[model samples]
Target chain A: MKVLVWAEHEQGALKDATLSAVTAAAGLGAVDVLVAGDSAGSVGAQAAQIAGVEKVLVAGDAAYAHGLPENVAPLVVALMAGYDAFVAPATTTGKNIAPRVAALLDVAQISEILSVEGPKTFTRPIYAGNAIATVESSDAKLVITVRGTAFAKAAREGGSAAVETVAGTGEAGLSSFVGAEIAQSERPELTSAKVIVSGGRALKDSETFAATILPLADKLKAAVGASRAAVDAGYVSNDHQVGQTGKIVAPEVYIAVGISGAIQHLAGMKDSKTIIAINKDEDAPIFQIADIGLVADLYSAVPDLVARV
Target chain B: MKILVPVKRVLDYNVKPRVKADGSGVDLANVKMSINPFDEIAVEEAVRLKEKGIASEVVVVSIGGAKSSETLRSALAMGADRAIHVLSESEVEPLAVAKILKGVAGEEAPDLVILGKQAIDDDSNQVGQMLAALIGRPQGTFASKVEVEGDAVLVTREVDGGLETVKLALPAVVTTDLRLNEPRYASLPNIMKAKSKPLSTKAPADYGVDTAARLTVLKVVEPAVRQAGVKVPDVEALVEKLKELGVA
Candidate 1:
């Protein structure tokens, strides 16, 4: 079986999500990476270096710069003739376009596949990870989005593959990008960080969340994350949210301060290597998955720990 | 302008689902069910649009079994003018659901359609976009803020990088994110009034759509459990443990 993997990129570099998607697509058979955007040439060159990729297809147009689903969806649909399967990471870009491609092809999409049992069978979590359902698709061609955290990033450098240019569909004129307000952070991206410090509603307010969590994050050189409660409470930006609806992370160390560990939040961070929980409430659900639990007031405990670090 | 909001009834967010002993599916024999949380936000946005005079009427719809009428009533109590319940006995995939909704849209000809980004039960997150494609309309999904302009809706979406703003023509589809608005709880008086509201029921066959499962479930399994680790007495011990693990 031949698989086409959508190589998502940002700032002209192949995003980590693409690497994980390559890891998933490699499971089926030979993988060909498709990079569609203004900077597809550079991104395709980078994608060609991934170990398992056989070739990189570069489709470029000024219209594809913003990764708008309306613009990107058509490009994917146009290129789906030969491949038996199409795969992309379950990121915002992938989730937005994969369904449209599936709809255009008259096939149902299998989303966020956690495990691939065969060419057509997969496992994915449902109900906020409270249950796992294994499903099999009988469609002639499969369209899927793989959860990045479920797969290891494919090797960055190996045998070089040939990069070929593909035709661009140009703008569909259905939608236009109206600028974005991405948070500029000096720390590592939350999803790919080695250590993550997450705060919850217990941080009370934004000022307190920054005052308490930032010190520890700074000391440990960890990316700062927040539970949905913290994001909904306006204690932090939604970009910092780590949960079922937010960015999923499997960092080396995950420290949950004041997070109650609702299943939604746990679904994002439960796969971390070492988990630690600190909250005033001993019965917080976070303790159940925590490799080390500390029952203490975060206000006092975080400060003391920050000073020591 | 009539606004259509599709709500789904799923197991309550607080309830932790249990896999059946036979590994078929989650046990829903006697579980509490409520409108999906994100769908509640969509309903709230539609009602607010009506209150703001941008929408003349709010019509809440659900495509599910008879029990889904209860969810529609809850939406009615939340200030929807009417409800449409498309009854289906078996499972319906997102593509089929989108087709059913397209049929309903053809009949109602609403100016706007609002829906949750994804149903928590399946987390497919495909219906709204697919419906937009089927109906040949633009869509602004995962919307955190929606502004009704003349003949268009300016939506601020909560994207991965940060927030992205987009403009879609009227007769568009908008999916609600969590931060869209805090859904108002239905009051006693409104609940009483909702009992008298018009609720029309139809089957998928009436819409010329088949509510059949496209994907077969091989089996359902309980996720691997994470054993709780040892608890330390205080912050110092926790620090020591982290140091021991070489994470600090």
Candidate 2:
């Protein structure tokens, strides 16, 4: 099978998530990488160096500079003729673009695939990760998005494939980009961070969330995360949410503060190497997976832990 | 302008699904069901648009079994003008749902379509985009804020680490995220009134679409379990343990 993998990048450097996607596509068959952006040439050179990539395809166009799905979807559709499968990392850009490509091709798309049983078979979590379903697709052209945490990143060196240029379909002109407000944080991204400290609704409000959770997170240099309840309660922004509906993180250490451990929140972090729970309720479901359960009030425990650390 | 909102009934977000003994699928015999949380937000957004006079009508639609009428009624109670239930017993994937919705959109000629970014049951997050692509309209997914002008709608979407604003032409699709709005509870009087409102049901075949399973589920299994290790009496002990592991 000839599989085309979208090489997701930012600032001309490949994202760590795409390495996992490359690993997923390489499992199926021969792999080709497509770099679509204004600086595709620089990115293409980097993509061509990833091990097991057969060839690199570059579409250097300003319309794709921000990777607006409206522009990227048509480019994928135009290049879908010779490939049997198309894959992307299940990131914001990939999630936005792959579905449109699948729809234009009139095929069903598989999202957040956890395992590749075969070229047509995959394992993915449904019902908020309560049940894992293995499914076999019958579509002629398989469009898939691989969950980054489920697979190991492919090696970044030891291969040099030829890079080829591809033309972008002119802009659809249906939607125009107005502006973006990106959070500038010195800490690592939540998805790739080695340690994460998450807060829950028990924190009460935004002030407490920052006052309690931020100190411990800063002491450990860990990424800050929040349960959906906290995000819904306006304790933090949506980007900080860690749950089935939010970003999934499998860090080395996951600390839950004031969280009751809803199943949806656990689904995103249960795979962490070590888990710790600090909540007022002893029966909070978070204790079920915590390696260290501290039964106490977070208001007191969190500040103490922050000082001790 | 008429606005359409697609809603789906799923196992309530609070309920943790359990796999059956035979590994067939989740046991839903006695599980509590409600409108998907995101879909509720979608319905709420539509109702707000109607209230603001930006939309002349708000129609809610669902595709499912007989129980789906209950879901549609709830939408009507929340302020939808009427309801359309596309009755189907088989498992309707995203593609089939989009096709059926396309048929309904052609008949309704809605200027705007609002839907949940994803259904919690399958979590596919594909229908809205698929419908937009099939109808040759633009989409603004994961919308946190929306503003309508004469010919276009400006949507502020929640992206990875930030927010992005886009202006899509009218006759577009917008998928709601959690921050869009807080859904209103259906008052007793409104629930009573919803039952008398018009509700039209049709089979999937009426839309000239096959709501068949394009994929077969080979197995259903529980995720790997994590065991609770030990408890710490004080914060000092926790710090000591973390230091021992070199994590702190």
For all candidates, state DockQ relative to the true structure.
0.77, 0.78
Model 2 scores a TM of 0.97
Q: After superposition, how far is residue B153 of candidate 2 from its true place, in Å?
A: 0.9
Residue A202's lDDT within candidate 2 is 93
Off by over 4 Å in 2: none
Clashing pairs for predicted structure model 1, backbone only? none
Candidate 1: list runs displaced more than 4 Å.
none
* Colliding pairs, model 2: none
- Report how far residue A11 has shifted in candidate 2, in Å: 2.7
Lowest summed lDDT over 10 consecutive residues: which window, candidate 2 chain A? A180-189
TM-score of each: 0.98, 0.97
Q: Write the per-residue lDDT of candidate 1 for residues B157-245, one digit (tens) a residue.
A: 88888899987778889999999999999999999999999999998999999766779998988889999999999878987987887
